[model samples]
Target: MIAAVSGGSKDPQAGGGDGREPITAAAVAAQVGGVLVGDGSIEVRGIAPLDRAGPNELSFLSHLRYGQWFATSRAGVVLISPELAELAGTPSTRIVVAKPVDAMVALLARFHRKEPRAQGVHSSAVIANDVRLGEGVTIDPFVVIGEGVVIGDGSWISAHAMIGAGSVLGRDVRVHSTAVVYPFTELGDRVTLHAGARVGREGFGFVPQANGVVRIPHAGRCILEHDVEVGANSCIDRGSVDDTIIGAGTKIDNLVQIAHNVRVGRGCFLASQAGVAGSTRIGDGVQIGGQVGIGGHVTIGAKANLAGGAGVIGNVPAGETWSGYPARAHRDHLRASAAIARLAKIVRPLEQLVSKPFSSSDGESRANSRADSRADSAPDESGT
Candidate 1:
């Protein structure tokens, strides 16, 4: 049921310059192993949200919250989860799957744009006499390969990238444009340093002295294990004494800062703008949300989750969810927040009472009125 949509160079195939073939609803269903329903003949050329999808585009519904946009969607083909299958929708073509988002991701991998492979070293690249390059390496223009550097097979050093002296890059490593790999750094296989990423940079360490501050020299290496990807503009500082290591399969988002001597474990995900101070140890499978700041020398247990904007100053237990400033257990943080809100309500009336100006006359009047009311309510000495 594969259909071909006629187009020029605008729609290139994944990993190739060939024009993308038009995909039909039936083809998508087959690719995701989804149960096809309604019209299998519908052609899907692009992907979009349910509300924004057109007749030539595909859409997905993974969560019930987004089901609000389902009925009115003009999408030609809809890939939906089983739970959302019962919901009525306008799209005539449907692909029912266990995970609609996963299905969509698979389709995106098939059609998404990929960087064109650049083979051979550019004439403008400066390679040191002792630098060793493996088979099928691509060194783009303005790239500088320092002495004693070893670039493994199929590695790509993008334009303006600088590999410092004695650095080692494994097979299929990608150093994007403007990325700087400092001296003696080790990047494992399939490691990707995005544009402007600074790896193995000297850490911020200084000893305060009476005369002046003495900068501590960093002599340790920065090591990124296999499949670790550092996002654009992220900075990974080299250690002062111990090696700074990022474990295999860790994905760091843009603008992240990993300070000196920090050890991040395998399969950890660090969101954008997250900063881990020096000497911190993060266990495997940890998830750090955006803008989270971790203090120095702290240890985060494996599988611990840090909520967005959390200020972590202490260790987090494994598998626990932490949030709020001076991060604590998620439940405790919520309870503390609720208590503060309740306390605020209690304090408001007292605040108002204390804020009012006091007058002697008003107090005396109130006292007299209370006395009169008591007298009226009091029983007479004689029988009434």
Candidate 2:
């Protein structure tokens, strides 16, 4: 929350911020700690882009790419960065800031509206006799709490969410609708499981026997550290023997898959559809792009980056960027791709030559030779 004006308009109400309060350009500038260069009394209601903002709306100029739109903008007030503040713009009021984007984000809370969460457990929720719930917990309708489950204060279990037996959720943890927490799983404080997320599920481990295959039972827990957010429909499998642990502040996109015994370090960002095979260790602050595939037992060092669609088969060094199938260094991948393109260009001419028949000159020469051969072979017309 950014510091703002002490008091002028009505306080923001629950579920709707500034609905009855009229925000002015001065108030906006004061809230974001920006310099006011124009009319401070102009009223603004909502935020929009420069091209789309009307006379009552506030707009922002953050990047040079959007500077072109500023000249003809009709916005009543604009938050402009110092670099673009002197640029030609038509707005009546300008609030100059070092970081316009940050200022805009701060102002967003004033206009953002969200539904109020109801307090206390619903009548239809099912809680076991031994379940321990902390203060300010809100359990939605049809949510199931298994025996020995413990949820800390301010935790919210959405409708139809299931907490398995012996699972423990720390303070302010949120389990969205239909999300499942398997038995003995642990979620640290401020962790969020989005709708339909599955945590602590059994891994796909099987041993091939002569007659058939035998499934290995998973006996380990899945643990998410503080501030970790699991996206909707993502699956994190419990370890076959050891725990599957996600470090603090890691964010996983939708449809991600994490196999058993995998350990992810802190502050990693994994895009949608990324899959990590079993027993892989990913270090801190790693950025994995969309649809990247990491092989089993692999090690990715801290601060490593994996590009989209990369297929990682081995270890990745720290602070490196890797891409392509059988992922290598980014520069190496680029070189290989460039070489392949150049080779294709070279092969194209040869392919065309091979596909063509005899050239015009060759055809003419062959025809002349055939004519001479026919003339020589023609029976001696002299009748000698």
Candidate 3:
């Protein structure tokens, strides 16, 4: 177990005790090739939200909604896109970039801990016989490598991770703390498995037999191509016959569940808690929002985006954005929502009209009778 650092320390700079030179905003701007619009010599100790940043903190502006805060933020420096540079006003230094959020992400990675493993393998690690390890591999404490496992060069396996027999990990791959890769799973170069990620797990396949329901044997593999990253606690099940494949540059967020025989294409982004049922084929550049559930045997075409909480039951064509429970087109869903809202406004009036004791003609007659009665009740001083 990794020892927890005590938070009781009063010193703000206590986190960095190595005596290394502190990173300044100018240094970050230089690294990302962004031009500094204000004082480049200012030293920013930490990064914070735009609204909560202090004098020693760095904040970012990427959206128009935060433009108001950017003008008044106490941050020492602000990273902003070229489009939002005017909003920063005077005084505050701005690092202008084409993509401010991406630049901010690069800066965060530079400041944060990049790798969990120490420089070398731990003393308590267990390596099985006939395991092949490449150069510059770092295995943390209590990690277990099964027999015939092959780890490529420049890979880092975090503490307490288990690599099953005959599994192959490519170069520069990172298996985070407590993550498990089952036997026969293959990972391409630069793959990242976050903490508690499970690869090549048994699929939910069952066959109803005469006597009882029998679990189907998962005899296939799970393959993650280059640059694939599995988020924390996400699970990728092994195939029933063929390999369940995750294409290059695919990113899956936390709590995602990918069932057996699912084929995910290149550059796909699956958000948190998104689930793809068995045998679903997701095309390239598809974006799945958080908590979206795709039914089994479905096919989502390239560039299709499913909005949050969408339930997809059928096939989706290319370049469409869908949302809502049944998952219709985004514009159609918005139109339906607007229609419902308008209906809500008129519903009370319709209800009152339907429940009224008198019709329109009866109302007119009553109005005329009241007018005649008021005339009769009036004084006859002006009468002929």
Candidate 4:
């Protein structure tokens, strides 16, 4: 689901008109260094897709296949690539750019309205006595801040987020609605925790007891370096005694799970639903595919590529491609799979022979006859 401000003007050509000036198509062409074709005087109020755009809307043609609709579109202004300019016939106005899609994105961002929140703490928020908030911080309604928590400058805490005691958040960190940051967690600058993301949760560790299993105490914290992003519904568990660290510039997808003491290095891309067991160290620039499971205590070296649904049972060396369960080298796994296919062919004939019932003497005679037939089939020096 694409999360954005909801319940605003559904019309693409409308603006908030709150002292923010609207931009024109000619101004956009001049700023982006594009050529203006057709009518340069036509004005556009907002941006939208081709199908839903109205007379005041600004649309674009990126792919060549969609060029057919450009001539029939009622949009007041059209952003077109140089290759698509010929296909657009006498539109209201046209701005020719090298990349039409990128130009459209730039135009949409300039006109989008932001949801407004009061710049101070709301009456419904519950902040503990010992918590320290920096200047210009905004705490939305229903937000809870525990004791000894420190939130840096310009941080926005959405509704229903629970910031545990002693947790520290750096500047410009955005904690989405319903996200939980447990006790003693640390988040660096520009980190974004999507809605329902759980940080510093208890790791899955247990011990056998006389009556039942005893839950291990999680005494450590979770540390996320600068520019890290966690997707919605993902969980990162705290360590038993040491901090679980996710290095800078790592992007984790939705529903991912990182167990206790797992250290993920810088610039790693973890796809959706990927899981790493306890104490596993994943090296820098590693690409782990969706649903990949790495066993506990295993080390994955730098630049390793793990395919989707691959299960790692042992340590993987640097710069290797791995796939399949009990993951091996990709080439070796394919060779082993081919050998197994050939073995199945040989086993099927033997199974048919063994399944047939026969007398003991008949079986012995059949075995002797087969041996003689094999001897006769062999080449001899002279004909007997």
lDDT of all predictions, in order shown?
A: 0.91, 0.91, 0.87, 0.85
For lDDT, candidate 3 versus 4, the one ahead is 3
Stretches of candidate 2 off by over 4 Å are 1-20, 352-384
Off by over 4 Å in 1: 1-8, 11-18, 354-384
lDDT of 4 by residue, 1-384 (tens): 112333344443363222245567788788777898766666566676676666666788878777557657777778888887777453657888999888777766666666664577878899999899987788888999999999988788999999999999999888999999999999998899999999998999999999999999988889999989999999999999887999999999999999999999999999999999999999999999999999999999999999899999999999899988889988888898899899999998889899988899998999999999999899888865
Global Cα RMSD, each model: 6.3, 8.7, 8.4, 5.7
Which candidate leads in TM-score?
Answer: 1
Could you give the candidate ranking by TM-score, starting with the highest? 1, 2, 3, 4
For each candidate, give its TM-score against the true structure: 0.87, 0.85, 0.81, 0.75
Question: Per-residue lDDT of 123-185 in model 2, one digit per residue for the tens?
Answer: 899999999999988888899999999999989888999999999999999999999999999
Query: Model 4: which ten-residue window has the lowest total lDDT?
Result: 1-10
Task: Give the distance in Å from residue 248's predicted Cα in candidate 2 to where it truly belongs.
Answer: 0.5
lDDT of 4 at 27: 85
Better of 1 and 4 by lDDT: 1
Write the residue-wise lDDT of candidate 1 on 55-117 in tens digits: 878889988888779989998889998888879878878899999988888888655655665
* Root-mean-square deviation of Cα positions for candidate 2 versus the true structure, in angstroms: 8.7
- Candidate 4: Cα lDDT at 86: 72
